[model samples]
Structure formats: C-alpha cells, structure tokens
Target: MQTSLATSVPSWAVGDVTVHRVDEIPLPPATGPWLLPDATPEVVAGQQWLHPDFADHEGVLRLDSHSFAFVVDGLRVLVDTGIGNGKERANPAWHNLRTDFLERLTAAGFPPESVDLVILTHLHADHVGWNTRNVNGEWVPTFPNSRYLTSRAEREFWAGYDMEEARRQMFRDSVIPVEQAGLLDTIDVPAGGVEIARGLRLIPTPGHTPGHLAVELTSRGGAALITGDCIHHPVQLAHPAVGACVDIDPRQSEATRRELLGSLAGTDTLLLGTHFAPPTAGRVVAHEDAYRLQPVPAA
Candidate 1:
C-alpha cells in the first residue's frame, strides 16, 4: 500500500471476465483510525498476515479508494465509481480536489461514454461521487450513455432517512444529477440475488446501508465478487467482529461478513476489495478459526 497512484492499471481474470482496478486516491493514514476504530495498532499487529501489503510493520492499516472495471456479456461495466475530481465536502480528504480518474478509466480500455452500465454498490459519498461530474457551472451525469443501477431498497432507505448537510450536499452534486437525467434505475434484489446480465448478479449484503450490495460475476465456471463496503479491509477477514463506524446496523453487518466469508472460504472465487490496497483481489481461505485472504496477483 503505497500512497501513490499506479501508472499501470492492475487487472485480474475471472474465467472470461477481466476485472481491472481503477486507482483513485489512497486514503490518508488518519482514515484507518477514524473509519475502523476497533482496528487498533495492537489489534492490527496481532494479524501478522496483513503485514507489508495491507498494514505496516508498525501495525497501521493501509487503505485505498478505488473501483473495479470489467466487461461481461458484451457489456462494458464499472462496479462502483470512486470519489470524483472536484467537489465540495465536509471531509477534508474528499473536499474539492483534482485527480486523473477519467484518464485512468480510459487507460483501462473502458471510457466513460463506452461504459454500458454503472453499478452502484451503495449511495455513500465516496462510493457515488463520480456518478456525476462538475460540468461548466453545474453538476451533470458523467456517463450519460450508461444505465446507473442499484438496489431499490438502497435508494428508498436513504430517501426516508434523516441525512446531514454533507450527505444532502453529496446527493445534490453526485446523485441527483444522474436521477434527473433519467439514467438511474433500481432493481428488486431477491434473497438469492438478481442476475442483471448473462454473468452479472447483484447480491444483497445489507448492514452498511439497508440496500448495500456486493456485485458477483461468473463466466465459464470461474467467479469473482466485488465487495463494496461489506468487507472493507483484509483485516476484517481475520476478525469478522471488527465493524466499520459507518455501519447502520453493527450486528447485521457482522453477520453478513461472517456469512459472505464462510461461503467463499476454501473456494476458488476471487474477492476483489473496493478499498483494498495493492493485490486488491484474493481468495478467502479458512484460517485458524475465521478466515484470511490468500492474495491473488492480477494477471
């Protein structure tokens, strides 16, 4: 977890589907302490497996802000959009800033206009910031040709919930513009999850948000999962009890993490972390009692 943005985009192949990691900004050191308060230095140090790549020898957790891109069934897709270039925000890290995200996307072989679908895992400020971009004097949908998809429960829950000014401002700039353009669509995610295309599915993994989702893709018997915020960092795999401060329901979040990890353990499925540092993709292997990620280097 170097803090610098990579020049070459790293990608992994899941059967016929190739998932690319689109680098955003590497979150500052403070992000670890604030986001996962329970992942203290001592707690992080105990998990020796996280060293060097995921955490420093001193036990500071390494985290990043990025998205996964790939193509499935003739559809050029982007799982989640990272924080946009320039925007007003209460958080110092996410406030008005500039980054070469769009250029990076193009380098990965999927330009904004070429993307057929933009799958939003949830409506978090950072997750959906790129849903729209500042155009001229107003915010507008960045991918006008793309169909933005998310779970129906996700949008409805945020609609009725009391949101702070920061959140409301985020929606005004990043989310509302997409909706007003009539490009946003919601789907009912059943218990078994809903398949959108031949090999793409939306699995409901609520807790972070009532409608939070984890995208799943399969082709030729090979499979991969894009963990939105359900499993934020690799450390969580070792200590499933550790939950993010942003979780709406800590209990449910823990349960969801356990279930997802349990099902993937000892399987060949590749787990691509939305916020994981380099070697962002891995397989969940059963460790002592819980599980640990067996890093899968991108091909």
Candidate 2:
C-alpha cells in the first residue's frame, strides 16, 4: 500500500546546494485532528494540513510523507526517516508499516546506499523507523554505510527512562538496533552551529524533545533551515502557544517556537517542517500578532 502512492520532493537550489523531499508515506485525509481533547475545529481551520478534503475523516489526523533532504558538498544527507517497516504500537494506523522507503529514496535519486548521513532531530517512532531494516531475521541499518545521527541528550533520556509503554516499545524496535549495529552517532549541538558537512550545521532548537535540533545549511553565502517538529502545523503559526499534546515540555516548546519563528521571519532562511505537506519549505511572515506561513510559490 505504501508503494502505490506518488512521492514528491519539492526541489529548489539555495545558492549552491540542492534540496529535495524524499517522502516516505502520507496518510490519506491529511488532516482533521488527532485525538487531543483540547483540539477545536475553529483553531484548526485554514491550516494546510487541515484541508477541506479531510472533512469526512474524524478523530485522527492523517500524516504525510514529508521528509527533508540535504545534498551539499558532494554528500547526500537525509534529515529524517519517516515511519518504516515493522513498528508496532497500539495505534493501528501506524502499527507495523511495511513501506518501501528505500524505493521512495531511490525515486528521489539517492538510493539508500547513497545517503551519507541520516540525522534524526528527535527520537520519535516515526522519525527513527527507517534507521534500520529487517535483513534475513536480523535488523540492520537501512542505509548500510551511512552514519545515523541523533542528539546525545535525546538518546540518553529515552534509552534510560520509564516512558509510555508504546514509546518504549518503539525504542526497542526502531532505535536500539541502529545502536547495536554501531551505526548511530549522538551529535551534540547545544549551541547554534556544529558542522555536519561542508555547508551544513546542526542548530539547537530544543522544545518537543530535550535535545531537538534543526539543520542549518550555508553555501555561497545563502542559508536554509530544516525545522524538525518546531512548528507541527501552520495553524500553530497563529497560535504558537498551542503546542502539540505529545510534546514532553510544553513551555519549552512554546518558547522555542517563538524564538525560532521570530528569528527566521522575513529572513533568507528557508524553513522545512517534517509534517508539513509537499512544498514543505516556506518563509515566515509576521502577521497581526503571531506569524503566518509564506509558502514557496508553487512551481
């Protein structure tokens, strides 16, 4: 079922680097609302994720195959790997997906083996699912030779905590395998910049997770930013205080949103959101009191 849908990676050149969206899988009905008790239809309106096409769907928000790709300085890097095969949880929708993320990666021109680095902004199940794949009964790094990058703080916290059962199970299935394979690298990006490649650096944008980081790219004097879960939906643009119910630290998430959005508004910086739909990249604009998304003009 994952292979039947069309995959698109809105591409653009930011100075010298080329970026693409190596999408994994998108849930139909795109949006409505997850099961958050506080979610109000009024608050979710006019959001791209909440397209009118989703009016018939109820109780759950469909997800999209939105992932970021960074091709710079002769290296190909994947910002996040969406939900992969065999991830089991209570949520039937996301339980054990047998996706062809590798095929999707190939469709995007960078086969799994071509990916030099896989950077996970946080340790959520969806983000790390593709870190490894089942190989003849043993789990192995999906991108055989690529280094899997994640935050040290996030790795330690989840590795040694009493988390919700489902999440802990996610760690056991999707994350630990990469560690055991010695393909995981815990990147420390507390400050703003830590070079990952020639022009790519890791920026600390912690909020949703204790060590959440956004990727910053610079080439020929131009810059772009991959905002991982900092702003889940554009509606959050109007109500930055309404952080995701799944966020571990709501107060910190809110503060990160304000600071990240405030700094990127009207700048040359391009913003890429994980759950944001195709044409996932955009610029920020300061609206009435909050903020607004100025999506890249369609090609």
Candidate 3:
C-alpha cells in the first residue's frame, strides 16, 4: 500500500531549539528477516500501526539514511551524518556514489560552513560517512568550522578493531581524515549524561556500539530524544529483543531498548528515529507487554 510521504525537510521546535530532517537517501524496502534476523513477515505483519509509514502492506520495512540538523541556542549542531558521496564502504549499497545531502542541508538553511558542531553518536560507517568529503585529491572535513564530537571509547575501539578491508577503508577515508585535520574532539563517555549545549546533551546508550549515545534536547517544557542507532525501527519497539545483526552486543542492545521505551512511553517526549522512514519523530506508547510508536502529527 502506498501512502503520502512526509515532507523531506520536516521541522520541529523543542522549546527553543529547532530541528530539520535532512534526508540523503530513501532506502528500498527490506525484508524483516534481513534487517532484523528474528523478525519474520508473519510477526511484523501483526504490527498494524507500522503499515503505510514504517512498513509496507507486505511487511517490508521502510528505512532511510538521514541526518538531523539542530539549531540550539543559536548554535548549529548536526547529529549522525548520513552515508556520504564517493566513499568506499563495506556495504555495497553505500559504495562510491553521489548524493545531494550537502545541497539539501544548504536548502534547509544549514550550509556546511555554518555548522558549529557535528556529533557522531557512534563511529559506524553510515553514521560518520560525511565527516569528511573527497576534495580535489584530499579528504577534507565537510564542516570545516565545526568541531566534530565523538566518544573516546568509540574511537579507541574502532581504531584497533580487526574488521574487513572495506571497513578499514571507511575509517581511513571518512573518520581519520577529520582527525588529521585537527577537527575531531573525543569526549569522555558519560556515566549519566553530559551537556553539550545549553539545552542539548548526550545520553550514553551503549550496546549498539561500545560508545553509542543518543542525543537529548530540552527547551522550556519540551523534550526530544534522538535515538542514533539504539532503536533503528518502530518494530524494535514491539519486539525489543529482536536485535540487529550489526549491533556489537545484541543482548546489551536489547536491554537498552527496553529501558528507553519504558522511560519514554506515554510521555510528552518526542522520539526521533535515525533510520525510521517518513514521519520519523513519534511518541512511544505501551502495547501490552511491549511498546509502539505513535507518529507525531505533521505541523
């Protein structure tokens, strides 16, 4: 079934902060088993609320790779740079190609040069792809003036991780280049949480990666949470135990999911999913023994 898609650039105001969604690519429908190993079609089909938005009538998941541009206290901050153009990646789908992400960012009123800070929730290939871009012949920081922030644990883990050749190439081309330019800032992972700006902070949500952190925004009386990769899709809200194969620790990821869902359910806090399709921001609601995502009405 086909449904009218949300605007590519959706904006939301959290008290004083303004956020815009910058989409790089709308991924093709994926099978339940492929994206979430334990989620079968029969199981996903039961998630009636996911249809026409997060999933198709046939139970195929609708996912996207995008970034959130946040304007906090007059400071421009971006969360999770999407898979960039012209980068060699371990995933064939992300291999060298061209995208208009920067252009979209510009159109959304966030030119790369204006970004004050670029936060990488984790050092995954997709999350940090746009940290740097291929210039004349050198890899250069995309947001030249922005101070790139990432967790110390994440940088250390990936630095020595024995991964495939392509992933190594990803780090060399996308991550290391930023460090070489003296633009990367490794923050100590917080036990509780640490404030990055006036109303913005990083909440450690490890398990997906050693240092994965979800961004929290609070302004006035409004609150929003950006789930970097801890909760990829709404399906995970229903089956918190169905961990992604890419997660470094599946069990840990599961625990984090349940905790987050339980804490945010029936609250006014807005949940922004990093990979959720259109209408990406929603509110968590309790569903029997698990949870469900109720998309926020478009404004």
Candidate 4:
C-alpha cells in the first residue's frame, strides 16, 4: 500500500535556504510503548501540545519516514533518504515499497540526478534505503552524480557491525551499492561540527546512533535544524528522559535530547523532525521544565 500522506509538498525558508519535505511513506499510528517504552498513555496525556499532529487523543504516536531536501546556494542537498523501493526490509511495511517518491521529488523540484549531495544522518535501514535502486537485479546508486556523505565513525562502525540478518541485508542492498559505485565519501566530523556548505554544517548528535549528526542551516541570521532522529516525536520534547527503544544508548540518548532541546528552546531556530508527520517542521519552545514543538504555520 502507498504511504505518502501529504497531498502537497510542504516547504519553509530559513534565510536563503528553501527546505522541502519529500515523504516516502506515512507509517501507521504506533503505540507509545512501541517507540518509547517509558511513554505510556498516561505519560503522553500530559503532553497537551502533541494533540492532532504528533499524537492522537488516544496517545498513539504519528510518524512518517521522510526526507528533507534543502536547496542551498544553488545546490540540492538531501538530509536523509527514506525507505526506498524494492528493498527487502524486515519490517513488512517498509519492504518492497513502490510509492511515487521519485515523482513527488521531481514535482518538488529535485530530480534524483539533480541532487548534488546526499547526507545520511546515520546508517539506519530507513535512512539509507533510497541510496540505491534495484535495476535488472543489480543495486545501483540512485543519484548517479551526487556524492554521498556520512560520518567516518559511522561508516567504520557499520563496516564491522555484526548486524542481524535483516539489517545485514539492508547494508548489502542500500549501503554497499552506493559505496561500490564510488559515490560514498566518509568525513571526519569535528567537535565544532563540519561545514558541508556555506551556512550548513553537520553537528554531532549521537546516542540514537553512535554517530548520528543533525544538519544545521544558518543564513542571513535565520536558522533551522534538520533533526536526524534526535527526537522522533513532539512528545519526547515534553519528556526528554524518554528514549526511543532503538536507541543504542538509552541514557545517552535521553541526555542528548535534553541538551539539544534545551539549547534550542526559546530560540527562533526552526526544528524539522525526520520522522514527524505532516506539518513536520516546527520550533522548539520552553514548556514548563521541558520543551515542546510549536509547528510552524503552513506557508
């Protein structure tokens, strides 16, 4: 079944950079326990700001597997690649997806060939699935001209990772093919973050994955953050201690969430969540002791 939920492409601008959300699939409503084991319905009920968009009245979390495409300084850079088509995923919903992601990407003004850079936030199945496409029983780089960027630490970790059979398959189909195509470039990210382009940098935001990096865009004094699974849902903002089940280090992920959200709270920085549903981009605002996502009004 098709999972692209947005009827139209949602976009926002920060300084000179224009960001567009290209959704590959809309995941079904997941229970809080499935995502954050500590987040029960009672716990989620207290986060009133999550209603309608991030969560339902029943406390089911709304999420999407999508990518944020940034047009920066005449360059097309994609933050993350959503679950691609024709891949065998352990998650049945993600396997063999034949959605109109490419068509929608073109409609959003980003053809695969036109993309100059593809940034994988981390080496996760969902994030890197679209790195390659299956053609004539051969996996090949989808963006032939683009240079794929990922953290050197992340690439090294996955290189030696004793992954489960399913995830190993993901590495083979989605990640290996890109490397084999000679389009992959692993960068040594600095403590202060590495500037991939003028006004755009990859800030290390680990814990979710040991080497996860969030994309920061600053231009003309305006700023926006492409959160690469740092905080999956708005509910997490209200309870930073709650960590995702998939977090490599739950405690560290919680701490990172608090630090990241605390820093952005009360600031004008726009927050674009990688897994957030429609109206995915928002601002972090201080709410009580924690933070909350204030969804930016549709443009």
Best by lDDT: 1
Write down the TM-score of every candidate: 0.97, 0.88, 0.95, 0.95
User: Backbone collision count in every prediction?
Assistant: 0, 0, 0, 0
Q: Model 4 segments beyond 4 Å from truth?
A: 1-7
Candidate 2's residue-wise lDDT over 41-128, tens digit each?
Answer: 6555544444532222242443465577768888889988887888776666677887666776777677888888889989887788
Tens digits of per-residue lDDT, candidate 4, 20-108, equal 88878888665346767787878878988888887789877888988988788767998889899999987777889998888778777
Candidate 2 shows a clash count of 0
10 residues in a row with least lDDT, candidate 4: 1-10
Model 2 lDDT, full chain set: 0.73
Question: Which sequence of candidate numbers ranks them by TM-score, best first?
Answer: 1, 4, 3, 2
Per residue, candidate 3 scores C-alpha lDDT tens digits across 192-211 of 88997789889889899988
Report lDDT (CA) for all predictions. Answer: 0.91, 0.73, 0.86, 0.86
- CA lDDT, candidate 4, residue 77: 93
Query: The CA-based lDDT of model 3 is what?
Result: 0.86
Q: After superposition, how far is residue 101 of candidate 1 from its true place, in Å?
A: 0.5
lDDT of 4 at 204: 86
lDDT of 1 by residue, 103-190 (tens): 7888888789999999999999889988988778899998889999999999999999899999999999999899999999999998
